[model samples]
Target: MAPYPPPQEAATSTLAERVGKGPDQNPNDTITTSPNCNPNGQESPTGKKTQASPTAIPEIQWYYGKHESRIAYWLLLSGAKHFGYYPRGTFNPFPITSALRRMENEILQCLSLAPGSRVLDLGCGEGHISRYIAREGSFPLVLGLDITASHLAKARRAISGDVLRGFLRQGQVEVRLGDYHDLFTSGTGIKMGEWDGVTAVETLAHAVDTKLAFSEVYRALKPGGRFCFNDYRIGIPDDVVRNESDGEVDEKELSPQQRKTLKAWRWVMRTGGMKGSEYSYAGTYERLLKEAGFVDVKVVDLSENMRPMARWFWILSLLPYAFAKLFRLEKAFYNSVSMYEQYVEWGGWAYCQWSATKPAT
Candidate 1:
């Protein structure tokens, strides 16, 4: 509407540098850069606007790359690749790593998966969860799939020495470059109905198309297989509903500051590969799973249980926020920090444990 502001070349490049090169590093060559681009933001010889290009947004991708790189680096630093589950809170007397181990064990218990079952860890970063499943649950074959090569490399390194038995007898776990949205469509080299269980941890929210992703998961699982994961659920305040129509929520009704906050929040989620446009609400996952041919779909609210960890994140976000504001990279910084704060404070989002079963014939 405002002429879409000339490509912020300097800022864009800086942002890209901060994260890593996006899917494409050359910023000026974007679909929007063409002179013949039409009113609908599409390139055409006729110069007639039809619809926007379906290409990924470079800024968002760059932001996510950096965000993921940061996560990988942090995992490298922690030597554990996770912020260990702090169900009670970070200040508790129990050790963090032990809690993390316990959390994984608890999740596996819920899955009721037998040893030697094949588990696919969707959106698996560093294969921490997959490794845990393999080592603890004795799930001989575990596959971790992620879009980031670096993260997958980290996962591979982390699970390198594992020597359990099953589909992949040489290694207890494996890592692959795959995206949840294209698990079935793209050539993942994994067969349908091959997995006994699939686990996604704080990952499904990042799905660009929740329905498509769910459907793909459905197709990937064996009959009687279980899909389990935890992720954020939408939880909006009463005053926040400015506009709601056509399967979209308009935040124009929010205050100017609130609108800016929402913008920053989305940028952060986008960096994590989460699509706010396609994100599901509290009860939506159950319905979507049902549509995807899943049965016994259950979405459990674990918001209170996850708050302690959220509190820790809130406390940790301070320095980054200051650094961004200091360097005037506030917009890029907002992509993650404030969005997390909203989850921690305003009930903007709820963390939930989800499980669904593919029924046996």
Candidate 2:
């Protein structure tokens, strides 16, 4: 076999393989998972060689001092029933805030499956989504997979997170540490005609490679199984530059420089741990999904039904991550969160939620 890569090779790291890339998130909760580490091209549980770097290009986003981001987030939101920015930490605040409870209800509705369905929640933080599926009175088996040990750790310590109010609906819920990329490469994880459903919310943006990510999802599902989730594409607007075709600009269709800048945003995320990729106009997303092997792809503007609260939530959502390391506000972190929350409650912000699905056999 080929020699393994170096320590910086994220895909092969003891930590990275154990869970995919760590999720940089915190809204109302957390997500976690675990697994072995092997940097080789294949998933050799054997743990025998060196690691291989997943990419030739540097990543755009990374978990820059993420541990600090997590601490700042939880400390700031203590005792709050709902975050209004990021529900349970993995879902979105935009759709929820925009449509009141409708967005949440709609997503839950979209996820409603017949009994005995096998479901996978990628980037399942704190197991809330899986918990919901468990209580959902539908899926008999619900699995939430995430790449953050802290998230899995917190889920394991559900008693402490207090934030993970999972359906408490029985042992139907399981949180595991694994990467979607590896999950795709490992055919056993998905039986050819086995899965009934697979759902990912607000997570595709975090994948190291979106195109390959969809292909993995496609391989995991049975024909006709719905691969539904809200994800971001490549085009988003800056303060300037508007497209003539539509009221807004399509960054995907922009000039080369704009395209490079757009892609660079993702680069910053890989290195800095911030995400600006995955977010683009719905149409552009539709095109990419088809190119990725996802058929019958559709984009829904759940944001139309979104509330101002979600906008408010995402508007200041970056605070914890942005300031966590710079200020190392460890001592006054709680105070900072409190002030931010108060500001959001006083002001309002919202974001869009786009849901899609994979074609069944």
Candidate 3:
């Protein structure tokens, strides 16, 4: 296998140039450097100028840093943070490892990149799917990026183990601290049109600015490159009304039950560091992708394939949720709350996979 290429030199292009936008377009958009590095920037070992790391959001840090959250994810999902995909007509959700791999395989199929493709995995938790793509899909290099420090630490250790065991060549897969919103910025070391494929698994919903995030991904991909991801979306109720000027939901129009369910759902999203309103409806994603200059967009509802696993989570979380509620410790058990609200109580959430292509021309 070919060795991983050296990091790209920091480009001199302005944000508008990098994103193929005119100076007046998106004038309000801003670039933020990452956290934990020098404010003045420093030179990398590769002689590239590296800037500060992306700022880590407090909610993400709090949620992933909790011992209970870590234990629950490991115990239930076996360290795969995303939902599993069961075969159609299958009632059982056990043997979760297989189902998780199936979901990964589905992503690989959606990507359909040639061997030796350069790939980027955005919001990669623990680098499981990144490594899977490198190993099973024969991608020469897979760079996994995430904002959470704890998740990156685990991902690095797992990559190290894979290398030591001779299951993967050194540097076939790597994890870095990065924010999806800052992809084309200097500090992140990601250049425009740098990747043949880019993927986000349950990732983009956490983006603070969905439009900026989508634009960054579109800017970072090579022409004709594919972007695919699976994420959560809320079902908009028929009676809900939207503001005509900005198209935002009108809270006053929500029925009492709808409001309550939305509150619970938003709380769950906040625990994962996402603004629920931004990703509430499926149409939002499709419209945003088109606005970002992507073409051939497709969305598939995978909710049925994920129902068994959701049901399992709802079942397993019941006891712990009751205990947490009794003690008023629901914050520590937010995952349980997510399961209860998503599967059992509200049932307005859907699992969806989306794919889009950068226009070849």
Candidate 4:
């Protein structure tokens, strides 16, 4: 994909001009301070007081900080750390970089923010999506928050490079080391109704309390502001589906193969620092968004768009995964296991994009 224009050039273009009209929009690290903001909650160059650094979750740090995990993300994903979106009818995954850009465009469209809007990107791993929003120029001020120090270091370096190259304004994009849950708490300086839009891409799944996280995002958004995100939802077999609040699968109903898949799924989620039960139900997101006072909630299934990339990962992992299993190196190849389980055992997974608006009143 072509590089985005410098901030000055981008400012002269309309959003439509920057993002072509189409579904297919052809587009990791150690602890460090954000480019334009102190990671320790100091006042930023833009005069915005950032939140205090939240205690990093050890599981998350251990997982993403692993040598194998970093290499896998960099080699396969170019440090994007998210799935790509192949347009419907385009099953081939060769153009994965473009597909990844399309997925970012999807999120941008869902946000639908006006020029100069302020956005908060939770779990802004490597700050890829956050920088994308800034480069689009619609949201000139994009603040990224992530708990991982290594990822923040990488984000800082990238943002600094962009600023130095004039690709971004000095303080147009700033990332801080913080947690989404503490976004609106006292002393954090993140005021209620402060953000024009908030985005979390595949990050909320790691929140131990998804409802609390939703509430925090709702509080942080301005009245009538939008919250948009992409995440995974567990799919239940029709025969075993029930209206259970916890959304736990009934192990007894599963065949041995299904049981094995579930075990692998759990392992993947656990190792990835995700709260599996929070994502085990389809309607959990809608319910939580409503409970958090968001209106006009909408959820779109993007499973088909995600399938190509999942399949791509599965194919890439086969040989390595076989060796992993042979040598009991499965833990080192947890990402491979995740792809395999999600692709072959997709009956238990669903990829979704969701949007909800804070009530205007």
RMSD of each: 13.1, 12.9, 9.1, 8.8
Reference-based lDDT, residue 271, model 3: 73
lDDT by candidate, in order shown: 0.58, 0.46, 0.73, 0.73
Query: For residues 1-361, what per-residue lDDT tens digits would candidate 4 score against the true structure?
Result: 4477745644454322332221211102223334223335565344645432334345676778788788888987889978888878777887777888888888888999998798889989998899887787456678787877678788989999988887787667767656676664322335677788999998887776566578779878989999999998766453464444345667787777767766767788877777734345667788789988999999999998888888888998888788888999887887776677678777666889999999999
What are the per-residue Cα lDDT tens digits for candidate 2 across 96-184? 32332333345566755676677777776655556545444345566666665556656655623322343243334556655565563
**Deviation in angstroms for 172 in model 1?**
2.2
Model 1 spans with C-alpha error above 4 angstroms? 1-61, 67-83, 89-94, 163-169, 237-246, 250-264, 276-278, 332-336, 343-346
Better of 1 and 2 by lDDT: 1
RMSD of 1: 13.1
Runs of candidate 2 with Cα error greater than 4 angstroms are: 1-68, 75-104, 159-170, 184-190, 233-282, 304-307, 314-360
Model 3 worst lDDT window (10 residues): 22-31
Q: In model 2, state the lDDT of residue 307.
A: 33
Model 1 scores worst on lDDT over the 10 consecutive residues at: 1-10
What value of lDDT does candidate 1 attain over all alpha carbons?
A: 0.58
Candidate 3 Cα errors over 4 Å, as ranges = 1-56, 237-247, 252-257, 276-278, 345-347
TM match of model 3 to true structure: 0.81
Residue pairs with backbone atoms closer than 3 Å in model 3 (clashes)? 34-52, 34-53, 34-54, 35-53, 35-54
